[model samples]
Structures are given as C-alpha cells and as structure tokens.
Target: MNAILTVLEIVAPVFLVGGVGFAWVKAGFEYRIQFVTRLAMTLAVPCLIFTALMKTEADLATLGTLAVAGSLGYFVIGLAAWVILRLAGLDMRTYLAPFIFGNTGNLGIPLCFFAFGQVGLEAAVVMLAVSAIWSFTIGIWMVAGKGSGGKILKEPMIAATLLGALFLWQGWETPRFLTNTLDLIGQMAIPLMLITLGVAVARLTPGRITTALWLSVVKLAICTAVGWAVGTAFGLTGAIFGVLVLELATPVAVTAYLLAEKYEADSNAVAGYVMVSTLTCVIGLPLILGFLL
Candidate 1:
C-alpha cells in the first residue's frame, strides 16, 4: 500500500503535466511545436544536461559504468529488434530505431528524480546522454539511411554532455552567478518536455493499433530484460541499477515518429508505436517502480 502511494507520488506529476499539454492541444489552443522544440533542444535541454552533469555528486566510476552498460544494453536491444522485425516481416527502417531507443530524456530523467531523488537523477542523466548520442548517430542512419556525423557533433546536447563530463572529471564548478542562471534555464526542461510530449501525442494520427500493441509489449519486455542483465553484469546496485532499468523500460520516444516523418519512413506506423508504447508505460512503469522501490 505504501509502495503504491510512493509510485503514484513519483509518476503522477509526469503524466499530469503531459495531460495538461494534451488538454491544451485538444482545446484548440496554439502550440508552435517547432519553435518550442528548438528552444528546448537548442537551449533549455542543453542547459539542463550541462548543469545536471556538472552538479551531480555521483562518482565518475558509477557514471562511467552506467554509460558502458547503457551503450551495451542499447546495442543488444537494437540487434534483437532487428532480428525480430525481420522475422516478423516488418520494415526494419521504420520500426527498428523506435524499438531500440526509449524516452530516456523527458520521461526518464524526471521519473528518476522523483522516484530516487538526486542520486537517481545523476544516474539517469548518464543514460540519457548515452541514449541521445546513439539516437542522433545510429538511430538517424537506421531511418534516413545516412547519419550526419557533423550534425551530431554540432548538437547542443552533445556538446553539453561532453563539456559537463569534462567539468565533472576536473572537479570544477562554474561561477555562482553563472550556475544560478543556467540552473534557472535548466529547470524549465522537464516540464517543457513533458508538455511537449503530450502536445506531440495529441497531434499524432496513429494507425495499426493491433500490431502496435503487440510490438510495444515485446519492446517493453526485451528492453527491461536487457537493462537488468547489463546492469547486473556491470555490478550496478541500488538507485543506479533501478534507474537504468526504469530508463530502459521507458516507451518509444516521440522523436522517433518525428524522424520517421522527416525521413519518409511511414510516420503513421511510427506514431502508432509511440502511442501504444507510451500507453503501455503508463501502466508498466509504476509496476516496475513498485518492485524496484
């Protein structure tokens, strides 16, 4: 009973913020998604990642362990997803990336923070950085048939992740005023992302519900298993282990749908996956969190 409340406390705000966005969109209000996304990705999210990395008290060793574990976990999931999609006669280009990558940024980060506090947030950030790098590089190539190495390097999130890691390694801190400013900007990231997620979903017109439902279930099971195995292999315990599992088990990212749309890889199908997978998470995440807690 207590655990249920705890899980609710953690997850309620996440979905509620998203609900607001969904409602806002449904009410026929204007939401300029492109501008908001650009602002968040180019400025707010980078600030969030940079400050979180810079201020995190987690040791370099734990961070590094999670990084390696997350990388391996994603690689394994990608391979499994590719094989599964091929055997099922699904289009790899359209389905594989979404199957492999989860929403570790908007949903994962905040869930970690709420569920396990600061240490969890720190651990979650490492996984998010790892996931973002791969999504920008390999995930892009899967859908577009071409990866932009230059674009990945130019991404603000990527730069922030690298710079933040350097600062952490060097045991350095920014000036107080600067840190405060960055922190303020960074604070906007989570809420903005949650709301944006709702807005995105509300706008999507997903098809193929039956197939998407089964695929989403398969993705959740495979990702949870891989995250647990990799974290155990790496000797991750406590909050770090839990965070890794939870992050990995998050639903298909809305970004995947956007990428499919941009690259002309059956956007409606991708949207179906996103919708179904995310709905699955709404039920699945709390159960997982209950066990973890």
Candidate 2:
C-alpha cells in the first residue's frame, strides 16, 4: 500500500501539471505552453544533458553495457512497434514515432531517481543521454521517411551528445560555475514538460480517448515484456535491472506528437498515443515496481 501510494504521489503530479497546461490553452492561455516548451528544449534540456553527463562517473565497460542494452532494447521494441503498426495499417509518422520513442528522458529519469536513488539515477542518466542521441540520428531515419541532412545537422540533442562524447574522451572537468548554472536551468525541464502535457490534455476532444487506450496498452505491455526478458537474460541486477525495465516501460513521449506536428507527420495519431501511454503508465509503472521492488 505504501509503495503504491508513493508511486502515485510521484506520478499524479505529472497528470495534474499536464491538465493545468491543457486547461490554460483551452481557456486562452495558449502562449504559455509554447514558451515553456521552447525554454525546455533550447536551454533546460541541454543544460540537463550536459550536467548529467559531466557529473556521472563512467566506466568504459559498464557504459558499454548500458549503451548496448539500452539501444538493443529500444531497437527490439521499436522494430516490433513498426511491424504492428504496419500490419494494423497505421503506418503514419504520428503513430510510429510514439511507439518507437517512449518517454525515455522526462518521466523515465525521474522514475529511476525514485526507484534507485543516485545509483539508478546515474544509470538512467547515461541511458537517457544515449537514447536521446539515438532518437535523432538513427531514429529519424526510421520514422521520418528519409532523414534530412539539415535536420540531423541542426538537432540540439545530437550536438549535445557529440560534445559530451568529446568531453568524455578528453577527460574534461566541467567548470564549477557552468555546472551550477546548467543545474539550475536543467531543473526546469521536467515540471515544464509536465505542464505542457497538461495543456495538451485539456485540448483533447471527446473522440480521442479510445485510440489513446489502444496505443497505451501496446506501449506498456509490449515494451515491458521485451525489456524484462532482455534485462533478466542479461543478468541485470539491482538498480541497473530496475532502470532498464522501467525506462523501457515508460509511456510514449509527448515529444513524439510535437515532432509529428512539426514535421507534418500524423500529429493526431502521435498525440493519441502519447496521451494514452501517459495515462497507462499510472497503472503499468506501479505494477512493475510492485513486483520488482
């Protein structure tokens, strides 16, 4: 009971924050969501990635495991999603991106923090960073028809990952002042994202709920099964095990919808999947945690 409540306590705010954002837009406070999301993408998200990579200690071997496992897990599930989506005749960018790109960074990071404290947080941070790079580079090819040279060149997440990798190779110690500033900015990403989600929810029409539920089930059930199998087979233990499953089991990211919207993909399908997956996490994450924890 306590565990359940703890999970709820952490998760409920995401919905609540998202609901507020949705309501504001419906009530004519439209500009706030855009402003917050842009701030998160341009400043806070980069800061978060930089600070997390700079601060987390890395062993080449373990980092390799994390990268391999995380990437493989994503690839397996993402491939499955593509097959299912294609068979179901839902082969649009809107539908596919959410299925492929689950909420790895935002919800996944915080959940890892709760599940494993610093150790889990450390593992998740590395995986999230890696996954973010994967989404824009390899992942863009999978979803967006053909990858655009301009899109790849201009992506901030890609730039951040490359710079982080370079710094890692060079053994650079992040300056204290820069780290502090980035930490402050990075702190804003999660809440702002949640609020933006709320605003999106508020704008949901009456007919959207059914599709959301279907995608939610696919996102949670398929990914969780695949993740657990991979983690257990790989003999992942403790926080590493938990982080792998939970992050994979996370809902479809709202950014899938945003990207779909920006790229003129199937935004409606992406939005439906994101909403459904987010709601499904309320039920799915607790169940996974209950069994594992």
Candidate 3:
C-alpha cells in the first residue's frame, strides 16, 4: 500500500499536468504548451543538473562505477533496439532515436529518490552525468548520418559536473548564496518537467499512437529484463542497484526526439516513441518495484 501510494503520489500529478495540457491543446492553446516546454528544456533542466552536481558529494570511485555501468547499459540497449527494429524492417531514422534515448533524466531521478532516498539520488546524478555526455556525443553519432560532426564539446553541464567532482574530491567550499539559488532552481525542475511532458503529450497527433505503444513496450520489457539480470548478477540489489534498474526501465527520453530533430532524422517518430514509452512506464514502474523492492 505504501509503495502504491508513493508511486501514485509521484505519477498522478504528472498525468494530471499532461491531461490539462491535452485539454489546452484541444482548445487550440498550442503555443502555450511550446512556451512551457522551452522554459523547462532551456532553464529548468539545466538548473536541475547544475544544482544536483553542486549539492552532491559523490566519490570518485563510485562515480566511475556509475559511468561505466551507465555507458554499458546504454550501449547494450541501443544495440538490441537497433537489431530488433532492423529485423522488423522499421525505418532506422524513425525508430532509432526513441530506442537510443532512455528516460534517465526526469522520471529516473525522481523515482530513484522515491525508492532509495539520498543514496539513490547520488547514483542517479552519476548516471545522469555519464548519460548526458554520451547522449550528446556518441549517442548522437550513432543516429546522425555520416559526416554530421556530432561531437560533444565542453559545455556548462560538463563543467558543473567536473567542478562538483573536484569539490567532492578536494573538499572545496561552495558559496552559500550560489548554493541556495541553485537549490531553488533545482526544485523547479521536477514539476516543470512533468508539466512539459504533459504539454508534449497534448501536442501529439493521434496518428502515431500505435507506433508509440509498440516502442514503449519494447523499451519496458527488454530494458527491465536486462537491467534486472545485470544488476542482480553484479550483486547490486540495494538502493544503488534498484536505482540503476529503474533508470534503465524508464521510457524513451525526450532528448531523443530533440536530438533527432537536430540531426535531421525522423523527429515525429521519436516524439511518438517518447510518448508511448512514458505512458507504458506508468505501469512498468510498479512492475519493476514488484520485482526489485
């Protein structure tokens, strides 16, 4: 009961926010949805990353584990997805983005907090940092056509992660004011992401639902099974293990769609994949808890 309520508590608001956005779009207020999403992607998301890094005190060894595990997890899933889609004769450009991008950023982090508290959040940050690096670099290169130059340069998120790692390693002091400000901004990330997700759902055309649902099921089933087996085999069955599994189990990431758009792939299909993946995970999350928790 407690677990159910906790999941509902986190997930219900997300559905409601999405429902509201859906209604708004149905009423022809589409522009408002775009505005909100832009705010979340440009401001709230970055703030969330910055604040997480600033406040987290992750150890170098642990961060290394997370980086290696996360990279491995992503690679395995991406390869499997590619093979499956290819076997099905699906358009690589249409389905690849959604398959390549997992929902490690928004839902994964919050679910980690719900499952394992502070330790889970730390693990989540480590995974997020590593995943972000890959998503911008190699992940892009995988989906982008040849000669796209999809290399990740030094960016704010990377800088923040490095500085945060330095602080943790060296015991450096962070200014109180900056810390407080980041905290405030970080707080906005969760709610805003939920709302943005809602807006994205609202804007989705009805034509793509079937494709999205198929992709969602693939994401949930394969990723969860593989994550569970790997995590258990490695004796990682506690908070960190649970968090990693949950992260892997999350739906197609929104960044996948954005990256598709940037790389001139089939962005619409990526969007559909994200939508279906997210909805299915609402059910998939509970199933994961049943197995792991």
Best by lDDT: 1
Tens-digit per-residue lDDT, 1-293, candidate 1: 88899999999999999899999999999999889989988899899888888998888888998898999999999999989999999998899999999999878988998999888877887888899889999999999999966778888988998999999999999999999999999888889989999999999999888889999999999999998899899999999999999999999999999899999998999999999999999999998889889
Error of 3 at 53 (Å): 3.7
lDDT of each: 0.91, 0.72, 0.69
Per-residue error (Å), model 1, residue 222? 0.8
Query: What's the CA error at residue 43 for candidate 1, in Å?
Result: 1.4
lDDT, model 3, position 237: 48
TM-score winner between candidates 2 and 3: 3
Better of 1 and 3 by TM-score: 1
> How far does residue 121 in candidate 2 sit from its true spot (Å)?
3.4
At residue 163, candidate 3 shows an lDDT of 66
Deviation from native of the Cα of residue 81 in model 2, angstroms: 1.9
lDDT tens readout by residue for model 2, 1-293: 78778777655665566666767787886456667767877787767666666666655456568678888888898788888877877665657657766777667876777677766766776677666766776666656776655665575655665576567667786788877887898888777766766666566432356766887897788888988888887778877888888888888776676677677876776666676677778778878887777
Model 1 TM: 0.98
Write down the TM-score for model 3: 0.85
Better of 1 and 2 by lDDT: 1
TM-score of each: 0.98, 0.84, 0.85
Q: Which model scores highest in TM-score?
A: 1
How large is the C-alpha RMSD of every model relative to the true structure? Answer: 0.9, 2.9, 2.9
